[model samples]
Target: MTDTSKKEQLYELIRANPFVSQQDLAVELRLSRSAVAGHIASLIRERRLLGRAYVLPDKRPVLCIGAANLDRKLRTLETLQMGTSNPAYAEEVHGGVARNIAENLARLGLPAALLTAVGDDPAGSALQSRAESAGIDTRGSLRLNDTYSGTYTAVLDERGEMVLALADMALYDKMTPEFLASRAPQRSSAAMVVADLNLPQDTVATLLQDARRDAVALVIVAVSQPKMARLPQDLHGLRLLVLNRGELETRVGRKLAGDAELAAGCREVQAQGAQDIIITCGGEGVYHTSYTLAGEAGLTWLPAPKVDVVDVTGAGDAFAAGVCWSIYQGNNDLTLACRRGLKVAAMTLESPDTVSPLLAADILEEISEFHPLHLPQD
Candidate 1:
């Protein structure tokens, strides 16, 4: 059959039943699974088909608030560096915790909006343009005139592990509570509000307060170890909290070396009122726990799938996107959500770019077909 004929058939099938899964579509259309997946991806990319399952019709777009900046990296050709210069390769791209998460969500076919501050320079303009191109609504973002856009530079060893990094993100200070207050209506209308610690402490506090007062689901991403403490002590209205092992240690005010210590830290944060907590332990895998009126859900850990390491720049952001996407899709199973998060993070780990272009919902479905994640029992 011709491509147009196949697309028309697929469109008719979807219009008839919006909840049809890709496997079902393949069977009904008498096409290969990958072919059906590709067609669905193209349809979504061309705006002929919407991702109905990935988002709810009644919910507003997810609001993401935090840093947006340019990222530069230098990878040494060989291991050995002190004060002297080393031969290396250099590259640059637009990156920030909130920006990466927002882009990943958009790529996964979710309605996302970004509220960040950037200078009026070329870098800021490029960042905004790229974000918009990637389907993120940047209307709520700020454009400062005098300051330069934020930038993060990292030096990596030959194995692609980060050796050292430096950041100039003072522009994030402009994303104050006053700035967020100006966009109060937008923040209140969101289905979920996601923020990273790149924002100032006062801004984080205001966001927490607004989310609580408005009764919106708040998801916070710990940008780094130092910034994790910026989160408010009273997480009364937090729906989900995403952080790494180091960040969790900082928040709990102690060293956590084993599963026992990690579980204690998770309980401590749950006591602070967060409904769910996801901690990404580099290679060991991810630990997740959910709390409800019934009681605490037991900790569920999923081992990370083995993959060739490329650059671990935005794996955490991709994981956050997966969890947020799953929640927005109305999935309450923490274990399932963690599996999805790991799947997405694995995809990101294989890509050198921060956000892989192949992060679409359909593409992920196809990848999972061949390389399914084995979830641990509760």
Candidate 2:
């Protein structure tokens, strides 16, 4: 067989049995052990295989803590009327900042666990079941008895832009610091811990503290404008902070404009203890800064790939997942990680669902033909 075919065969076998040894491959393919070793080495060098197995060794299961809810969207076919009922089509799907991020990570072939509260309602059951089916460990999740599951309802215009929305996330209030303390072992063992602002302020504080104590990378996703204030004032020990310009402005308590101003805002947050900051600008793209052992890094901006916008909802969650996945894969390059995030966000923009099933596959390959925008240096 040609080397290409031999490589393909080796790839299939390794993927099928991640722990398969070289002797096993030689026995199954009726080839010399040396031949199998050569093919495997080629695969690893070509980037088709990751490390000694299909997954990286340091890529441990991520612990995602926040909200899991049923998302309801009402899309109007025509102009919406004010103070009057308008005819529209409605759709419901699984959603929640943390829940979506966890599912995205699982779909990307990473092991993920979710720690959040859900009601004893059917919607709650469906959410948990779907997450588990996607390979997320939901055992850390809570099923509250007296409350109904949280929900996010959005009214969209014909163009798919959100016109208005309501979030009934009172259920997340039950996910307090004391409750998280009960799950300390699981929290401390994860390679990374992600939390959204939907979590109570005290709960977020507790998570930050635990992340510091355990030396786990803590990634925070700012849920929304109003909720951004819930984050701890001192962001020290935060590994990554993903948010939009508005959210960053809110966090810094100032209005920022221009690249210089935004870069300064990133530095302000970094001074307060955040190691890396990614601020997403709608349509324009994403800007990121990181503090490494070499000292402060310059701002790197990657423009968003042009795509048809189907729905803006959940795009941020997708972005968060991509960045976290890159970090889990042991990539310390902030610019590349932000590009991965932008790629996932673009995929979400093309789908009405919070997360497109297409995201379950290799995104880099899917967009290989497209070129990412490179901004001019200052």
Using lDDT as the measure, which candidate wins?
2
After superposing candidate 1 on the true structure, give the runs of residues whose Cα lies further than 4 Å from its correct spot: 1-59, 290-298, 364-378
Once fitted onto the true fold, the runs of candidate 2 whose alpha carbons sit more than 4 angstroms away are 1-59, 290-298, 365-378
lDDT of 2 by residue, 1-378 (tens): 887898788778876655577899999887899999888888768777655444333444798999899999999888988899888989999999999999988888788989989999999999999999998878778899977999999999887888998999998998988899777555654788999999888888887787777688999999789998799887777999999999999988999887777878888888888888888887678888844345555466788889899999888899889999888877786777777888888889899889878876466534323233333323
* Deviation (Å) of 134 in candidate 1: 0.6
lDDT against true structure, model 2: 0.83
What's model 1's overall lDDT? 0.82
TM-score between model 1 and native: 0.80
Alpha carbon lDDT of each predicted model: 0.82, 0.83
Model 2 / residue 300 / CA error / Å: 1.9
**Which pairs in model 1 have colliding backbones?**
none
As for candidate 2, its clashing pairs are none
